[model samples]
Target: MVSKVKIKINDLYKIFGPKGESHVEKVKSGMGKPELLEKHSHVLGLQNINLDIIEGKIQVIMGLSGSGKSTLIRHINRLIEPTAGQIFIDDTDVLAMSDEELMNFRRFKASMVFQKFALLPHRTVLANTIYGLTMQGLEVKEAEERAAHWLKRVGLEGFEDRYPAQLSGGMQQRVGLARALATDADILLMDEAFSALDPLIRSDMQEILLELQEELHKTIVFITHDLDEALRIGDDIAILRDGRLVQQGSSQDIVLNPADDYVGDFIKDINRARVLTLGTLPLKKASTKGIALSNNTSLENAMKALVDAKKDSVIVVKGDKKLGSVSMHDIVHAATRSSETAGEAVTYR
Candidate 1:
């Protein structure tokens, strides 16, 4: 089934300077970032970015410091206007929205989760979660019910009256998430939402988001600098470098076939076995004796399952139907093969 596109970004460009628009031609004509800054005194934020964000899937945009990942997410809600381009949400041109229309769009169509847990420090957990609904003029009773449901859903059932200072970093982040979800908006824009948490808490938050996605499937555009997080949660990923999209694809595609030396170096140390799924491996005839595994099973978990069953291969299934089989040899080869040498054998479907 072809999923509808929830958001479309076309020829997006953002330059940070007084005369940024004047140099768009120069940048398009092969002017490098350093040269553009040195010669024109303009900083390129994004250059000709065209992407389709499918409905009900997580699209992760990642890069190091000075990359335009953060800038790009803001453009969706017109927090930062683009120098040139169009943003379409469900076919409505966001860039074309009037002041009132844009305000409505931000309040009703989209919700943002910030890295710093942008909860009003003065408001309690329940108040923060109901903030959006209240802003939308929902009845007090109705909004409270909605807020309470999401707070409990995010595991903050009793934290309703606690201030942000009283909760741990993880708990504060949960309030931020609950706020976004409470809005019940169709799109969730998470800007480095989990980056500030401790490692274990960060992992737990990722699991929570994925679990909610299974039931809610809001169109999520998650921003991050961590490659592992991107691979772990993104249904599709777009990598940005110096305002340009270096690569975009499934986690397996980028891991097995990096677009350039820069991307290759970025993923060199990633624990691929933990992120690469069985669906990435080539499908093969199933053997009757092996245990069954899901197509989305991680290579690491699949290996553990294989070892536990005393089997060398496992049949991959999606629901009740068998997709193919994967052997222990394939998992090891896929995880160990150098990106330079990766080809058909290691390439997952």
Candidate 2:
């Protein structure tokens, strides 16, 4: 079943300068970021970005510093207005909204989670969590109820009375997440929300986000520079380079078939066994006589299952229906194959 697109971005461009609009023609005429800046004194922030973010899916926009990843996400909420383009939420033109309408949209329709936690230093966790709700003129009792629910959901039930300064970085970030989720907004704009945490804490936060997503199914726009994080959390990923979108696809598409050497370099060192799933690999017809693995099982887990069961192959199933079978040889080949040699069809024997 095709998922509906919740947010649509078309021909998006952002150039920073007094005469940004005048230089749009030159930018469209094939001028690069550096050339535009060095020649015309305008900093190119985003170039002709087009994307359709599906509803109830995590859409990750990733790029290194100055790649315009942060810039792109800010555009979604109109925190930063575009030089030229259109942003549509549920087919409503965001740019066409009146100032009051835009204000209401930001207040009720979308919520942001910042990398720095963005919690009020003086306010208690409970108070910070209800900040947005209070701004919306929600009744104090009702806002507190909603805030408490989300704080508990984020595992911060007991810490609501604690100030942001009392909490650790991870805990503070959790408060940020709770605050965002408490609003019950449909769209979540997370701008490097976990980047500052230690590795283990970051992983924990990722698990929490995934768990919450399974239930809430919000249209989440997560911005990150880390490829591993992007692969782990994103349902769809868009990679940008020097203000231009370089590639956009699922983890399988990016890992198995990178758009270019730049993208291939980003994925070359990644653990393919952990990222690629059974459903992504080409399968062969075989008897469903041995152990069965789900279509979504990772290649690493599938390999372990085969080894533990002492089987050469396992039938891949989706629910009660058998899809196909995968062999140990196929798993190894798919995991180790480089993107340069990746297009050859898999033939399990």
Q: Highest lDDT, which number? A: 2
Global local distance difference test of model 2: 0.91
Q: Report the lDDT of model 2 for residue 17.
A: 94
Given candidate 2, what's the lDDT at residue 347? 29
Q: Candidate 1, residues 99-163: lDDT per residue as tens digits?
A: 99998888899999999999899988988898999888898789989999999998999889999
lDDT of each model, Cα atoms only? Answer: 0.91, 0.91
Model 2: lDDT of residue 161: 95
What range of 10 consecutive residues in model 1 has the weakest lDDT sum? 340-349
Name the lDDT value of residue 264 in candidate 1. Answer: 83
**Model 1 lDDT, residue 173, Cα:** 96
TM-score of each: 0.90, 0.93
Error of 1 at 187 (Å): 0.4
lDDT of 2 by residue, 1-349 (tens): 7899999999999999998998888899999888998999999999999999999999999888888999999999999999999999999999999999998998899999999998899999999999989978899899999999999999998998999999999999999999999888999999999999999999999999999999999999999989999999999999998888999999888998888777777787789999999888888995766689999999999999888999988799999999998888999899877777345443211
- Where is model 2 more than 4 Å wrong at Cα? 285-290, 318-323, 341-349
